[model samples]
Target chain A: MKKTLVIDGAPQNCALTRTPGGMRLLVGERSFDCALETLGDGRYRLRAGDVRRDVLLAQQGDQLWVHVDGRTHAIQRINPLDALAAGGRGGADSTLAPMPGTILTVQVKPGDAVKSGQILLTMESMKLEVTITAPHDGEIAEVLCAPGQSVPVKATLVRFAAKAEATP
Target chain B: MTPQPIRRLLVANRGEIAARILRTARARGITTAIVRHPDEEGGLAPRLADDCLTINGPTPVAAYLDVAEIVRVAREWGADAVHPGYGFLSENARLARALAEAGIRFVGPTPEVIELMGDKIRARNFVVERGFPVAPSAIEADDPATFAQRALAVGLPILIKPAAGGGGKGMRIVRDASVLEAELATARREGERYFGDGRLFVERYVERPRHIEVQVFGDSHGKVVHFGERECSVQRRFQKIIEETPSPVLTPEKRGAICEAAAGIARAAAYVGAGTVEFIYGAGGEFYFLEMNTRLQVEHPVTEMVTGFDLVAEQLRVCEGEALGYEQSEITAQGHSIELRICAEDPSQGFVPATGTIHLLREASGPGVRVDSGVHEGQRVGSDFDPLLSKVIVHGRDRREAIARARQALRDTALLGITTNTAYLDRVLAHPLFAAGDYSTAFLDEQAAALSGKDEPLPLDLLLAAAALSDRQMVDAATSVPAIYAAMGAWRN
Candidate 1:
């Protein structure tokens, strides 16, 4: 089976085949005979060649957090449907709340043209103020939240309409 | 005054400090009560305490900072003494005075001492008046009209700071005179915003200065002793990230001078309980009194490890009217200890605070290794409090062994599901300059590029295999066989 996973913000193609006592894993041009022993509680012992290391794993939706050695690598399996929706809407569609916070102010209304990196909203979380900015030059399609309204992580605060193509 | 044992203690704080104090209190056979905000109901501190009370405020941070609420809870809980661990109301004279008014012992210095040393300008003046070394500076409160002129006269490259500021907040270092006024205004504004006190002071900025502080304890019986010195020069944005005892740079002679100066200042103030006297050591070996912290410090464990003293226990004894019970000659330290602050921050991202649920936590432990952590597995780590999650402290016969052990401990630690500075700190420990103990307060800032290097790419196949095999859907798809094949069963055999 083939799968596309985003590792640390970069996408990679992977192939996996079940074999006797283990699995054959391929990434790019490299292959590995991988066997995993579940240690329970988000922990696994991975054996690949001469390397043997304990890996801890946790998942929230498609997002997976894997701890190997001393660092935790963030991985997410890309869903084709979600990618299609995002591509159809635009390169990057909306500004989502980075974390759970209360909206301090909204900078624009629907139909307002915004330049890339323009501040869209100001928010307060954990006593620190954060600013949400436009990812690309586009028109604001909708404002989903108001000042003083609390928001959860990943809550869409502002939606952007597809930018008009540049005139020749 | 004779010694009076405390029967019940109220820990008016949260996080690792609270847990640290509770451990000593329990060992000393004192009943303990802890305060927690509603948001921190599942925190580790409350779980360790004998009784927990929920304190309320407009926000979680406010709840912890609410002096009145903390005092009320302490009184209602029938706590005979209150230990304001550090930060929040730990240095608040109002809390100490209020507790004293209620006939409850405040496990710190008297309110007068707190108020005096809490203000930077007052503390500096006090030190100077008592023949202690202090850097030259100008105070806005002293003469607001001529403050700018006086600050410029002090010399070029002055640091404009709020008298009531700390933790690197509201400080502006002006190297050029042309922008001094603008930076001063900005500093004053920040001072007002962050500390709510516009009182500003300016001092000569010491280039490549090392921060060395002495841990001092005093009692009402008029006794003071020093626990050597701690070199906390490894800092980011004026906050110490790594701290150690017997500052590697200080020779025995210089060490004696600094420690004696620290003890002199504390004894003059008649300081009681545990306090730290911070000094700014210049390259020329001249040291100036920076300020005095009138409560326990975050890096006190390093001192405890080397000196074999329980600072919290000593604080309890001092507040209970007990003498230090030792002379200056009796206090001695051996070996070297290092402490690295494990914070929930992303060093690559300008050290901005990170928040997430701690899905998995494996604290470093072994011989000569200790982990003081306030976080537990499955607990949500939010920005409502300080980003410090824990401290990994290691001790060795010497500095080299301590560094090696600290690096190993960092590798041994695994705090998954959130971004932390564990890896960044490991890189710092690996730096040659750090290994040689040849660094100053600007170590992190100076070594930015070196420390921020991207980790060597690991085998992608292994990472992907781990991710894929652990994934439920992927594993099921890989393991499942066709229905026809299953139906065939063992027919082929």
Candidate 2:
């Protein structure tokens, strides 16, 4: 089975292939041998590499919430076909506005390459500044907003180009 | 006039403090009433109160700040005493006077003492007049142009503080006189905007000073006693985020002197109930009076943990005209206690206040761990009020044990569906400097890059696997319900 996993809106191609011993999991360019056991109450004991963690998991709509070692990571899984049709905006490659704010500065234009965690723009709300960052290494497909423009929460601010770099 | 025993008590506040006061009041066999704003109808404080009285106004803040409405509700509810728990109107002199006029006992000090200590300039002068050590300061002059001259005389690196400000609001630090005018104007505007008072005061800024405060209690019979100091130097933007009792830096001799000074000031003011005298302790062993909080402080739990005394209960007993049952010689510190404030903020994103419904809450509970929370599951948290959701207080035999306990307790606690500083606090506790207790007020600011920076990237494969497995479980659960399919088929038009 194959899908795209979006973490904080950055998507990566993921594939799960079953083997005699265990399941081989591939996310983007990384691969690992993993085994999962149900611990009940939305908890799963996952063993990958040297780590064996009891991960608390829950699903709310398209977002998957997982708690591990006091921190919760929220990710979304998207069908590959959906990503192709939406040109990456429908899946993990879209940057949605995190809060209602006015854009103070836009750092990237269309077709610009951005590294994961690079500041894409700055937004201001309630006297505090929030730096919108690129969630993954990708080229910008489109820029939907400009400086001084007011946007609501969840408004798509920037979309990443679908990765032709990943393989099945 | 002889004091009457309070039968029913009304807490004129909201959130954790109100809930804490309710606990003590109920334990003492006193019936309790809590005023609830419209936005906080389901807040934890109201749920804990015997009588939850609604004070309706045009807005939530207005209703909470309505003095006449609060007093009227207290009278109608047959509350003989009112406890203004630490935030809204906690130090408001008008509310104290109103309660007095209504023939009700206010759990805090008299309005005169509150007014005297509530104002920074007056408090400084009052303390100075009574031969207390105070930092050299200049009150804002009538002429705006002469403000620079007065500030220069006080010395460079001066703090621009609002006279009526208790929190760090409307405060500015001018490192040099070059930008004094510009900074002064900004501070004045902020003061006027936040507090109604634009009057400013300039004082010599103490660089990297440790914030130590002594908790004092007094009664109507003119007796005052002091609890040991609590060090609150772990600050960000001038607001304390972490506090611990028996300040790590204070020596035994200095501790005795600071505590005595706090008691002396309270006795001189004829203060009643609980109050805190804050001081800015310098590295060179010099300490100066900063200001006095005329009401119970937010970090009182640390003191309670170490002293084994219920501060709220003491306030009630004092209001009932009872003398403090113990003297200074009897007060003792058992062990180290630390309090970590759990705010509804996204620390990875500049600590911006996050607003959402609390979908899940699992408070940590074990030996020596106490959780004072204002929120519960399914409660809607808007941006209208303070972002403080709860507090995690842990006590241990020593600071090292307390730190370890706090780290473990914080890890066990979980508040989902809203971004919080829980993880950030965990990292701070693990930091070597913080663990060593060799840090100053500049700890957060100096260590910002290291503290606020992103953690090592989470493996993508793990995240992908979790998302996929969780999504599949959801599908399996939904399909197992055959009635849902029938409902779906009928819904198709």
Candidate 3:
């Protein structure tokens, strides 16, 4: 299966396939076949690939932990795309909606050059602020949505000009 | 359909519900695989499973709800089935169909059942078309004025619910016309954000309604059995916090009617495996079909305790294509059972899903106590998932015994690090309204202010000890000290 997910604002096409002992995920030419199990307490066990045998295991909405070879690693995720999604409207794939909320703040404008996953707008609904982020390292081509302006799902808020291809 | 019995199982969910499923899977002699997400503070699931897998993706869409990732591991690990405990993508007909297409037996109902029951508008239409009484509601409306007027026709204090997504998200209670526009907008936004569409509908917000849910099971052979009802009257923010079997409000006649109505609907859907039909019982004992959760419910343990059956095991049997071993008549309710959702939230923070590290822990115990937790004492509670740490279930010979045992059990429980509602739950279990079994959705909302205040005078002594004892220095020293030394370190530290 393949899905176009906006991660921190950048659109990544992720494709996953099943391999014995785990799942083989392909995202931008990187593949990981991870052993997956649901431990039942909202925790799952996943071992990525046999060679890179360092099992990197975690769950959704969790703070962050990685126990590789009996060593525990604590990490925190910086959700840039979430920030863009919080900022009211910009891109189809790059802009994040307000977690299904109403747009709250418009932070940036069109022609704004943003780093990967920079917050361009913010939306507030139910008192929860969701930031919409720049999908990639690019200049915003157009800003179509505004603060306090409600847009439905799949409503285009911004457009992104992905970095240009280089000839080798 | 019984091609082979599953050897290894991949559970596709997180939290207390996932922990509960692990118990049954572990008991059945199957190897369990889990996908650990970051920021779990190294949750309890790490220590329980045979082998663990971690995913880098953090959000529900990236992790648990990522069907492709889940299915890939199930196939790679040679697990025969994936049990979606509930919520997340449990009702996602596509996920169910994906597993089916992959030749892996997805535990629970077939994709057919999932689709039939998952489409809220369609399911409501199916039941209403079949003569079942459904609350009057409207679908998508182009104009907000037309929508609110239609909603008012249904009556005031109406509920603006997302027509697509269920499980209380994207739901708003518009008490009067004053806030209808704002509530509708929020509901639509939430609906679209959560469910990929913002379409919403409105319904009569029943007053003083008892939130009762019925459990139904269907076999490969055409047969459906009712597992009585679970009283989910005690709720917070429109979600069940505490659940009990043999609702105090139900008469024998009422119970039969509610259960029968559920069974009829399940039969209509050709429901297979374990499923729940939720209903709202009105003041005069009238019942309306609220919705059907197409997967295992969070409070299944309470039903299991009263029925003396394993729901996961039953799902497995149905997946194995065996006829249900028990009939509707054979099923009987036993002793009372109650479950308190021990969550990591400050009830003071409007139950804002709490996030922090767990410094110390004491799980409740004694006879008839079951604690299903996802994270351990040292783990951090992540903001990425539901804040439910564990479901503490207690069974007793009667409701009074259960209540008393629950109170005592809750009192003995100790959790330090981030604040929890343990003290608040303790007060709730002891409250006259709770003890008297007078429960409702509004029970907490009505008494929230008073409850917070009433708790102020009762236990300075215990809270002081708990607070001082929970301090970092004391806790740090206690982590190393012997029981006697720790007792002394209470002041020294």
Best by TM-score: 1
Ranking by DockQ: 1, 2, 3
Model 2, residue A119: distance off in Å is 20
Model 2 / residue A105 / CA error / Å: 19
Q: Of 2 and 3, which scores higher on lDDT? A: 2
Report lDDT (Cα) of residue A17, candidate 3: 41
Q: Which stretches of candidate 1 lie over 4 Å from their true place?
A: A90-168, B178-182, B481-493
Which residue runs of candidate 3 sit more than 4 Å off their true CA positions? A1-168, B1-3, B38-40, B56-61, B141-145, B453-455, B458-493
Worst 10 residues of 2 chain A by lDDT: A15-24
lDDT of every predicted structure (CA atoms): 0.85, 0.81, 0.70
- lDDT of candidate 2 over B374-416, digit per residue (tens): 8887777765567788999999999999999999988877776
List ranges where model 2 is wrong by over 4 Å.
A1-3, A8-10, A15-24, A29-44, A47-50, A76-168, B1-3, B141-145, B453-461, B472-493
For residues B91-161, could you state the per-residue lDDT of candidate 3 as single tens digits?
A: 88888888888888888887877877776777888999888878877765546557767777888888888
Better of 1 and 2 by TM-score: 1
TM-scores, one per candidate: 0.91, 0.83, 0.72
Each candidate's clash count: 0, 1, 71
Return the top candidate by DockQ: 1
Clash tally for model 1: 0
